[model samples]
Target: MFSMFRPPTLNIFSRSSRQKDSPKTDIIPHLTPNRFPKLIIASASKTKTEFSQQQKQSHLSSVKKATANNVENNKGPKADIPTSRSISTFPKKQLSSSPPIPRSTDVQPFKGLAKSPSTGTFNSVARIDNSSNTNPSVRVNFHLKYQTSYGQSIRIVGSHPDLGGWNLRHALDMHWTNNDVWTATIHLPSSNVVEYKYVLVSYDSKGALSWQSGSNAVLAVGEEDTALDVHDSWGNGPGASVSSEGGVATTREFKLQAWAQDMRSYKEVARSAAWEASRKKDELAAARAQIARLKMELGLGSKERTALEERVAALERANLLLRAELAQGKLVLKRTLEEAIKLLSQDALSVEEGE
Candidate 1:
C-alpha cells in the first residue's frame, strides 16, 4: 500500500529537479509526501500560464505590423500598447483586452489650394475681380434738335472708338423724339477727351451725307463726373464763327433758303394768283371808262373802237402767260424737295449696314 503513494512523491521530485536544472525555469519548492494533491494543481497552473504568454505574443506581433503599414501609407500615428501594465496580474486577459485607442496626427494640408497632377505643383483658387462690380462708370447724354424730311435721319460720328472712330460708315443713329428733337446716350471711359460731329444721312443715295458746318464738338470728361448731358442744334457749334464765310456755311445757307421756299411756295402761288386777278379787273374797268369817254368826244369812230378792242385782247394774253409761269415754278420746287429727301435717306442706310 505505501508503494502506491510513493510513486506520487517520486514524480514531484523529478519535476522539481528538472525545474532547478533549466536556466529559464523558476525553482519550484520540493514536494513532501503529504502535498501530493498541491503538486498536481501547480503543474496545471504552469501549463495555463504558458498558453496565455503565447497568445499575448501573437497579438503584439499583429499590432506592430498594423502600425508599420499605417506609417508607410501616411495614414498618421497609431495608439501604443501599455507595456507598463503588469502581465502577471491578468496574463490571459491581455490577449482578449479592448483594442488600443487611436491617436490624431499633426500633419495638415494647405487651404484654398489644389495639387496639379501633370505639373506636380500646388495652385491657388480662382477669384473674380470685384473692382469692376463696385466702381461706377461714366455716362454721357446727347440731345439735339434737327428737322429731317422723309427718308432722312440724323447720325453722330466721332474720333473715339466708342463713337465709331470718325468713320461715317459706322456712325451712331439718333432716336427721333419728335419732329425736330433727337436723343441718344453713350458710355465712355473716365477722364477722356472725345471729338464728335453730327451729320444728315440719306437712305437712298451713296456718298450723299451733309456734315455739320463747323469744327468737331470736343468734350473733356472728368474722373469725378459720372453723368453729363449735352444739348445742341444741327449746323450750330461754338466754332461756327470760323465757318461763317466758308463753302460749308454757304451751302448750309442755301439749304435753309430752300427749306423756306418749300414751306411758303403754296402761299406765294396763291398770293400771285390773287394779285393777277385784281390787276386784270382794274385794267378792264379803266379800258371801259376810256372807251366811253372817247366815243362821247369823237362822236363814234370805227378806227378808235377797233383800237380799244385790240388793247383789251393784248391785256388778256399777258395775264394768261403770268399764270402759266407761276404753275411751272410750283412744280419745280416740289421736285427739288423730293430729290433732297432721297439723298439724305441713302446716307442713313449705308451707315447702318456698315456698322
Candidate 2:
C-alpha cells in the first residue's frame, strides 16, 4: 500500500490509470506556419490593386470636367457670329449701273401723183344729096375735149396717107384739143348703101385703141340703107323704080330688101310646092314600071291580083303569130318586173326594221 501511495514515478513501465488512459503523441515534422504569411500577402496585394483602380477613375473624371469647361469658354466668340439672326444686318448692291435711253430718229413723208391728158375724138353723122341719090356719100365730124393737171399740151394724130391726090400727107400733129373741134370727110366708093363705124385712139399711149375687147358701145355699125338700088335683082338700071300693085313707088333695091321680104317668101313657097308635085308624079310612074317588070320576071300575067291576095293572107297569118309571141314575151316581162318590185319592197322593209 505504501508503494501504491507512492507516486508512480518508479519506472517507465507502469503508470497511473489516468496517465495510461491519456493519448500518446509523436512529434510532427516541421510545421509550416509561413504558409499563412504567404496567404496574407496575397490578400493584401489584391486590396492594393482595387484601391489603385478606384483612384485612377477619380483622376480621369476630374480631367474630363476641366476639358469641358475649356471648350465652353472657346465657343463664346464664334457664337456671336451670324447664326441667321444677323443676315439683315449686312449691306446690299445688286442692280445695274447704267443711265436711261433716248427716243428713235426715223420718220418719212408721203407724196401724191397727177394724171396726163388724152388726145382723141370720135364722130356720129351722116347725110345724102339729091343729085347724089343714084351715087351717095357721107360726112362725119369729131369734137375732142382734153386737159392735163400738169398742163401738158396734146395734138390730133391721124393715120391716113392719100389726102390731096398728089400729096403723101400722113399724121397731122395739130393741137386740136384746145381748138376742141375737128372734121373728117370720107368719100366712099359706090355701094348698095352700106353701113360703117369710126375708130378712135389715144395718140400718146401705144397699143391703146379705144375699142377694147367686147366693148360694143365705143364703135358700132347699123343696117345697110335700103333706099339705093345697089343690087338690081330684076336687072334694072340703078336709077329705076319698081311699082307695086298697091300703087306705091319703090326705088330699086337689093334682092333681099326688107320691104319685099314677104313677097320673096311667098314665091319660094310656091316653087317648093310645084317641085313636090312633080316629084310625086315621077315616083308614081316609077312604081308602075317596077310592077310591070316584076310581073314579067315571075312569069305571071298582068292579072296577078290573085297572087297578091294570097301573099296578103300569108302576111296576115305571120302577123298573128308575131302578135302571140310578143304577148308571151310581154307576160314574162311583166312577171319579172313584179318579182323585182316585190324583192325591192322586202329589202326596204328589212332596212326599216333594222333602223
Candidate 3:
C-alpha cells in the first residue's frame, strides 16, 4: 500500500543518458587553464572604468552651469570690473610694503603754511622806496641836533600841514636819541614846498617857549624828489640849498625882526626903571620939604627936630640908591643893544655866504 502512495518520478535526463551510452559521441573543444579567469577580470575592470568616466563628465557639466548662472546675475558695468592685465601690473610687494597715499583734501601747500619773518631778524628787510598807490605823498626825514637844559624839550612847527602849520598845539615832539640830538620823520606832498623851524619848549610851562631866532627853513619839493632829509642845529634853519637872492632877503628880514623885538624889550625895561626912579625922586622931595618946614617952626622941640633929621637922612639914602640903580640899568641896556646888533650882523653875513 505505501509503495502505491509514493509520487512517480519522470526521467528528464533519460535521453541525454541514452545518447551518452550510444557509440556515436559529440566532439568538445578544450579551453586553456588560465583564459577563464583572465576574461572575468577584464570584464570587471572595464565596468569600473566606465563608471568613473561618467562621474567626471557629470561634475564638469555642473560646474559650467554654475558659472553661467553667476555671469547672468552680475549687473555692474564692464569698465568697473578689474581685468587680469590691470591686476598683474600692480606689484603685490609694493602694495603691502608702504602706507597708502593721502587724498588732496588731507594735504596743504607750503605757501599757505609759511610764516612771516619776525622783526629785527635777518630776514626782515626795509623797502628801498616808500611811494605806493595807497600813499601818494613823499617821506621827509627831519634830523635836528640840540643841547637842552633840564625841564626842556625840542619841538618842530612849520608851514606845511605835516609840520603842524605853526600851531604849537599840533607841533610834533622830537625824539632825543642822545643828550643833544633830536630827530623826526614827516610826510609831505611830493610837489609842495615846506617851511619849518625848531622851537624850545619848557616841559613845565607852555608859555615859556623860545622859537628859533631866524627865518623858517624853506624846502621846495619837486616831482622827482620822493624822499628828502633835512639836517639842522638848534636855532639855525635847515642846511640845504636855496636860491641866493631869496636866502639873502629872508636873512635880512629875520635880522630886522629880531632887532626890532630886542629894541622893544629894552625900551620897556628902560621906561619901567625911569618911571620908578622918578616916583622915588618925587617922594624924596616931599620928605625934604616937610623936614625944612619942621626946622622953620620955632616951637618944635629938640626931640622932634632930631626925629625929622633922621627921617630926612633915610630919604636921602633911598634917593642915592635909586640913582645908582638907574645909571646901572642904562649901561646894561646900552651894552645889550650893542651885543645884539653885533651878533645879528654876524648872522646876516654868514647867511649871505651860505646862500
Q: Which candidate is the best by TM-score?
A: 3
- Lowest-scoring 10 consecutive residues by lDDT in candidate 2? 213-222
The true-versus-predicted C-alpha distance at residue 138 of model 1, in Å, is 1.4
Model 2, residue 344: what's the lDDT?
53
Q: 1-355, model 2: which lDDT tens digit per residue?
A: 2322332123312332225453222111111243535534443545555645744554454444443344356552222222233344522221123333544544445556533232323211222233534544423222333332333322223222211121212222223433343333333223222221122334544222332121111111112322221111112123334332233445433222442343344445555555554565465556557656777787675458567556556655655555555555555445445534554565476468658
Error of 2 at 145 (Å): 18
lDDT of each: 0.56, 0.35, 0.56
For residues 1-355, write the lDDT of model 3, one tens digit per residue.
3333321112313433445553221121111233535534443545555645744554454444443334346542222223333443534343233457889989886576434332211111121223442335656666677777888877778775446678876566666676567766666664344567888887656433788876666555444455555666665743442222112322323334544565567667776887788999999888888777767876588898888888878888988887887887787577667655665676687689779
Mark the regions of model 3 whose C-alpha exceeds 4 Å error after superposition: 1-135, 241-355
Candidate 1 residue-pair clash tally: 11
Question: How do the predictions measure up, each by TM-score?
Answer: 0.29, 0.17, 0.30
> How would the candidate models be sorted by TM-score, starting from the highest?
3, 1, 2
- Worst 10 contiguous positions by lDDT, candidate 1: 120-129
Q: Order of candidates by lDDT, top first?
A: 3, 1, 2
User: Quick one: how many clashes does candidate 2 have?
Assistant: 0
